[model samples]
Target: DAGVTQSPTHLIKTRGQHVTLRCSPISGHKSVSWYQQVLGQGPQFIFQYYEKEERGRGNFPDRFSARQFPNYSSELNVNALLLGDSALYLCASSLGGGNTEAFFGQGTRLTVV
Candidate 1:
């Protein structure tokens, strides 16, 4: 089975612009979650979706949002990007929500200038 994957291993954007990151989860998986990891810090959960419905969200601003698709893939969108938004955008997937173990992808490194 294919594992979770993220596109554009790295990205460079200017402040005030918007960016979108993509993800594809493993086969048979129905849950996808997004996280942000700043330098030297653990990943912070951003959003989680199961069966195309939002299941959980973390302490992030409205500028950060995401959605899961029927095929179990997902996309994270960040608007009005700021320099602080520069970080590793991670995509994780699990069998289902709750206490399930999640698999992470390589991540998209976003750099805002």
Candidate 2:
């Protein structure tokens, strides 16, 4: 079984720019969640999508948004990026949104200059 996968591995952007990070979930998974991990901090959930519907969201600003595709892949779009937005954008997948253990990708490290 293929595990969750993310793209770019690393990214660099400037303030006020936009960036999109990608993720592909494991097979048979229906829930995908986006998280941001700052240096030395735990991963903070940004959004959770299940069955192609928004299930839960985190405390991030509107600038942070995401969507899951029919194939269970996902994309995280960050608009007007800021220096504080520089972090490891992690994507996790689970069978459902309840309380299942999440499998994470290596992450796309985004650095906003």
Candidate 3:
């Protein structure tokens, strides 16, 4: 089976712009696997959706949003991008909820200028 995959591996945007990142989980997974990694920090949870419903969210502002698709893939959208939003956005795939082991993708590196 394929591991989780994310698109555009890298991006660059200006403040106030919007961006969308994509993710596809392992073949049979049905959960969310989204996180943000800063220069020297651990991954920060962003969103988690299971069975097409939102199950968890982190302390991110409303500028961040996401949805899991019927096929188990997901998309993360960030509006009004800020310089602080520049980071490596990661995605993972799990069998069910947060407790399950997850497989991660290469991540999307967004650089806000």
Candidate 4:
């Protein structure tokens, strides 16, 4: 049994570029969510998807998007990146939605210059 797993543990991108981060939730789980963590701050929820549909979104701009697949894997996509976008992108999965206990991945560290 494994927890949530994210891909490409680290990445570097330029401003105005696009980046796609991947995640695969634990077996038998249906809820997948994405979060952004900057140094000195807590993780901010970005998007949550359950059963392949988006259930919620955070205060982020339109440049952020995500989707869950039938198998419960997900991808977080960011367009028109900015320096502010540099942070650790975390993926979490739980048995259900909101406030439920979730398992998180190590996260993909993105740097935009």
| TM of each candidate vs. truth | 0.97, 0.97, 0.97, 0.97
Candidate 4 residue-wise lDDT at 46: 99
lDDT for predicted candidate 3 compared with the true structure:
0.93
Lowest lDDT 10-residue stretch of candidate 4: 94-103
Q: How many pairs collide in each candidate, listed in order?
A: 0, 0, 0, 0
Local accuracy by lDDT, each model: 0.93, 0.92, 0.93, 0.94
Superior candidate under lDDT, 1 versus 4? 4
Q: Is candidate 2 or candidate 4 better by lDDT?
A: 4
Tens digits of lDDT, candidate 4, 1-113? 88889998999999999999999998988899999999999999999998898999999999998888788899999999999999999999988886468889999999999
RMSD of each: 0.8, 0.8, 0.8, 0.7
- What tens-digit string does per-residue lDDT give for candidate 2 at 1-113? 78999998998998999999999999998999999999899999899999899999999999988998999899999999999999999999999887469999999999989
For residues 51-113, could you state the per-residue lDDT of candidate 3 as single tens digits? 999999999999999998999999999999999999999998899886459888999999999
Off by over 4 Å in 3: none
**lDDT of residue 11 for candidate 2:** 89
**Could you tell me which 10 consecutive residues in candidate 2 have the lowest summed lDDT?**
93-102
